[model samples]
Target: MKLYPIKSGNFKLDGGAMFGVVPKSLWQKTNPADTNNMIDIAARCLLIEDGNKLILIDTGMGNKQSDKFFGYYYLWGNDSIDKSLEQYGFHRDDITDVFMTHLHFDHCGGSIQWNKNRTGYEPAFKNAHFWSNQDHWKWATQPNNREKASFLKENILPMEESGQLKFTDLPQTDMLKNSPLGFDIFFANGHTDKQMIPMIHYKGKTICFMADLLPTAGHLPLPFVMGYDTRPLLTLDEKEKFLKLAADNNYYLFLEHDAHNEIITVKQTDKGVRLNHVFTCNEIFN
Candidate 1:
């Protein structure tokens, strides 16, 4: 199996919102912010190429939103989803599965796109089965007030409307059995319900796709939870458990939103699991 890092695009978000309860003096050291306190983040996705299946982990924010909507996030960067796929000599039609970590616009928006006429939306990956959990689907479709803005309907609904949507059963351990993808799904509820983090076993190394649960290496600390998380207390609990496992087992965390750092490993320091080392994906893959 081969894995490729697919960079969708880059966008700026309020650093304070990204790192809840964490002081600017602390987070700004790593993810420096602008005068407006917005920090640039990459909407990085992962692609898995197995024998017959080509699975894409997440779709970054697509270019379908109106200019007014995009004005807020300030999406900038030359690396697009198409360009990233072409780097690996593939196209959208080549994907067989689109496993969404959640239904947030930045995570699943690129799964759908505007039609030629701009009258309706269509599935971006025509040949891929878009995978989302049933509970997450319901929660996103009927979003609460706090998260309603992030769950855009244009980025969703089209998957099911196109008959390419498939819901994975909760606690997806059995779903990954004997799968050539060489990954186990770790479900956590802190950052939106049923966010699936793919724990991949490659060449005797375990690399986990740290979705919003651990957006960047700067978020390694226990209290660096996001304000967007519906349940911050649950996030603290989940992070403690996951960080312990990651440190003990020497798992390389593949950060999804970190622009500069691709992967990092943690060690059990006196201050708890702190970052031990940082490396690029290509370096480790090589």
Candidate 2:
């Protein structure tokens, strides 16, 4: 199996929102904010090439949204899914599975795109099967008021409408030992209901796709949960448990939203789990 870090795009978000109640004085040390209090973020997806299947985990926000809609996020950079895929001599059409960690626009938006005439939205990967779980499918489709904005209909629905949507069975417990995608999945609820964090065994190491569960290295602290999380307390528990496993097992965390830090590993420190080392995608994936 081969894994590649796919740089879909970059954008800036309010540092305060990204770090929740954590004081700017603290988070700023690791994730320095710009003059506008916006911190850099990356829609870093992952591509898995194993035998006949080429699975893509998450698609950054597509270019279908209106300028006014995108202006809010303050996007930056020219890195796109197409360009990133081409780097590996592949294309979006080569993706056999688009396994979303969640349905948030930044995570799954690129799964759909405007059709040729721009008449309506359609599945962006014509030959791929879009993967989501039943619980998250419902949570995203019938979103609550707080999360509805992040779960844009244009970014979703089209996969199902195109008859290419497939659901991963919800695990009997929080962690699914084996998934149809051929990886262990840890289901996290603090960020959003049933956000599946893929635990991929790669190159003799476990490379965990740390979705919103741990957005950035700055979020390693227990209380540094994102303000967007619906259940912050639940997040604290989940983080504590997961961080312990990560530290103990020496898992390589593949951060999806950390623009600066591509990958990291944590150590069981006196204070608790803390960042042990940082690695560029090239250093690890290459």
Candidate 3:
């Protein structure tokens, strides 16, 4: 199996919102906000190339939203899903699975696109099956007011409409399972209900796709959780448990949103789980 980091695009988010409860004095040191106090964020997705299956982990925000709508996030960058896929000599049609971590616009917006003639929406990956959890599907479709803004209907619905939608077939008793794509995933509910984090066994090392569960190295500390999370206390509990597992097992965390630090490993320091070493996929894969 081969894994590739896909740069979908970049956008800005309020540093304060990204680092909830954490003081700007602390977060700014790492994030270094702009004049508007927004921090840089990447919609970096992952491409898993296994026999007969090309799995895309996320799609990033597509270019379908109005300029006025996008102005809020301050989208910036030349990188795009098409360009990123072409780098590997592949295209959207080659993707057999589009496994969304969640329904957040930045994470899954590229799942659908405006159809030809711009009449209506259609699945962006025409040949791939979109994977989401039953609980997350419901939560996203019937979104709460707080999260409704994040779950844009255009980014969703079309997957089901295209008849290419599927859900993880894990039993209720299991926290992790062997995915059809030949990797293991454990679900976390703190960041949003049933956010699945992949634990990939790559070349004798475990590589985990750290979704919003751990956005960046700045979020390695227990208390620096995102304000967008439905349950911050649950996030703290989940982070403690997951960070322990990550540190003890020496997992290579493939960060999804971190722009500067791509991959990071944590060590059990006196201050609890802290960022140990930073490496890119180039270093590890080489």
Better-scoring candidate (TM-score), 2 or 3: 2
TM-score of 2: 0.99
TM-score of every model versus the real structure: 0.96, 0.99, 0.98
Residue range 1-286, candidate 2, lDDT tens digits = 9999999999999999998999999999999999999999999999999999999999999899999989999999899999999999998889999999999999998999999999999888999999999999999999999999999988888888899999999988799987998999999999999999999998889999999999999999999999999999999999999999999999999999999899999999899999999998788877
Report clash pairs, candidate 3: none
**Pairs of residues clashing in candidate 1:** none
Once model 2 is optimally superposed onto the true structure by TM-score, how far is the C-alpha of residue 260 displaced, in angstroms?
Answer: 0.8
For model 3 the local lDDT of residue 128 reads 95
User: For model 1, what is the error of residue 266's alpha carbon versus the real structure, in angstroms, after optimal superposition?
Assistant: 0.7
lDDT tens readout by residue for model 3, 1-286: 8888899999999999999999999999889999999999998899999889999999999999999989999988799999999998999999999999899999999999999989999999999999998989999999999899999998999899889999986646425578776788878888898888888898999999989999999999999999999999999999999999999999999999998999999999999999999998889866
Best by lDDT: 2
User: TM-score rank, highest first?
Assistant: 2, 3, 1
Clashing pairs in 2: none
- Per-residue lDDT of 114 in model 1: 94
